[model samples]
Target: MLLKSPWSPRLAGVEGTLCDRLVASLSEDILSGTLSGGDRLPAHRELAWSLGIGTGSVTKAYAVLERQGLIRGIKGRGTFVSVGSARRDALIDLSTNTLPLMLTDKLLSRTLSAISRRIDSDHVNLHPPAVGHDEHRRLLARWLGRQCVEACPEQLILTGSGQQALWLAFDILCGGRGIIVTERIGYSGALALARHRGHPLCAIGMDVEGMCPEDLDRELRDHDSNGRRRLVYVTPTVQNPTTRTMGAARRQAIVDICRRHATPIVEDGVYTLGNDPSLPPLVHLWPEGVFHVSSLSKSLSNGLRLGVLLAPPQGIAQARSALEAIPMTSSPVDYALLEEWVSNGVADSLRDSLRGEALRRNNLARDILKDRPLLTDDSAFHLWWPMPHARAEALAASALERGVSVTAPNAVRTDPEDDESGIRLCLGGPSRAEVERGLSVLAQLTSDG
Candidate 1:
């Protein structure tokens, strides 16, 4: 006996190919509560027959939805809607890992006004240089210098964001032909980029110091034995989710391992601005072998959409040329605004203010979950609560039911089978009151253990 599925997607007027349109319709329904969490979905063949679409399209749509964390499938029980699927506006929304909006209307208006008055015909008419203008790079280099990163403007390639910089580094360094090594738990953006590019990835185990140098050496040695190319990507300072910062010795050791293996590194320093910058980044240790990436989104304002890729002397031309080939979304106006902010000390002011706000949120979380263990520091925008994978997912579902959103475990863990799962609570996206409320909910839930 065949039972009809309760949910059916309306694809009329939805734009895209068959598969894309199907995905869009289903996503809209799921997010809008037309289709709900835990509702059983029709099997591919069943849905295809009902919708008059090919089974392949249905399969593809399901894959897309699953990737977006909107749906899930159990081998025998069949596919079902994911409980994590909810309209973002209805929740406290702690999943987004970005600095909260601290920019006042007055400051932004002043900055834009200043930029508009300075816009010249030549600046507005001409296309930006492939690697950004010298003045823009110079200001960015000066900003990096303040953070203890020594680099010249010539070696810097301006990017739209930290994610784009990572994309460029992975594309050029690996060329989708080699292995990408990173920590077991890493930034979701980088991991997704590697997977999307079809670059083979391996995760190194970590200790209290962050990426284990000994494990990295062995992995590189094994891969090198096969004449394979490998690139190491790491986030040593305030590592994503875990919020672990490596010391000077640990950084040197990891750098030494990669240098010994003759493998290049793409170091992510986006979070370094908010942390203690006394410890030098890996690029400073081995500038010729590391591609350092940083951006102003975390510190100043995400609206700026400005980032820089500090390449080695030998790789400067190649990185620049590669970036030039891709169509850039940033405009001359954006660069001018960044340049103005950096020059007038507005950038530093915003960062200091955001840092204070983040610290306050962190303290609140600490007070609420004082007895519970956390993988967080006072400087980071997010905190991690480690638990079993099943428990983590359960906690997320529980929090969602209470109207407090959190990052799903699948977004953070590299292996689904790994027992150690973590739930990342982003404190920077929501207001201080909302963050406190969310933390209290989590505290109550965890206390029920």
Candidate 2:
């Protein structure tokens, strides 16, 4: 049936029966390893016409095979058999992916030179201040002030990274047994910290705008049995995995809701910085209630591992106390390097360059996956594509076989219910060649089915 369907020019009268037989035969071929990994199926219409069957029949057959985990699709790309069943060796290493681009050699050389000068200075071995040395603090404060115009230097607190800042915020706002609200498909780090610290995490529904404010208020009101307070964690700007940026109206609504409930919010702005300057940060709007956190790792360099924590004036004392207990002092060298970058405007330059690169990569992605609606922010470094079929596991396995690593949404979730069957393709981590190759493979997969 498979051979006849592929070669026959006219079976018009028995098209329906022939299509049924074709589906069955193809399924056996897939199961038997005849149509292996990276193998492209004929175009849907072409295949249908070739076998003299109605296109709908071929469509239904493909859908059935997909649902049964026999084949996979990548929107604009072609379909292929699941890697494990076909080859068992295709590896796409997208799990825990990093940004595709790296700091230019010139920038790295300049940073190294600055670090050398700092080390050679006589005060190198001295212990830095608890809040951070004045010079470094000033640099960070300036950086933050520039990005969040409404913010002053007094509002900024330097931390080792965004995760540290998150821990500090959570530690200050909620302790053991307190209720915390996060997106249904939230960042895993926050979830893990909540679990280890014995805090209760309530998954809240989220759309493109971000955590649904109505859902959040309801969860808090329902869960606050004794009128006890709760803390809400959100990534409002270029949210991870989903890449959804909350618009102004939605942000205001969220702030209003949180204020009405008197709920403290931890706004993770790690990916928001150095991109669009117009989108006012939650910190800018709700400085008194929002604990804003950002890291240089994503915008500048991951190895720097430096983050800034901006706390509401009222919560400063508690946040500072928490930070002191865990990270009494950040590494001097790292701080010095970051300070040098910020002071000389190197960090800002890198950020600007990265923004352009991100746009380019995003544009490339949009062009490549044009057939699929990509959930992405042009200025952000990642693109989220919902699978036409929920075969993220199979697709990821297939991509991995081709030496392209892509992150499946399943691994990014904290709760099983929060998991979505999609993939996040990062444009910042791999070399341009590698990214192109990986994306090419992904494009093919999505288009096939």
Winner by lDDT: 1
Please state the error at residue 43 of candidate 2 in Å: 45
Residues 297-385, candidate 1: write the lDDT tens digits: 87677787887899987887777678678944366777777778777988777778877887888889989988878888777898888
- Looking at model 1, residue 128 earns an lDDT score of 72
lDDT tens readout by residue for model 2, 187-299: 65676677767876777887878789889878766665464447889988888767888888888888888888788899988884444566778877777899888777777
Candidate 2 structure, TM-score to reference: 0.73
TM per prediction: 0.83, 0.73
lDDT of each: 0.79, 0.68
Count backbone clashes in candidate 2: 33
* Clashes per model (N, Cα, C within 3 A): 0, 33
What's the distance in Å from true for residue 410, model 2? 2.4
Q: What is the lDDT of candidate 2?
A: 0.68
State the lDDT at 256 in candidate 2.
88
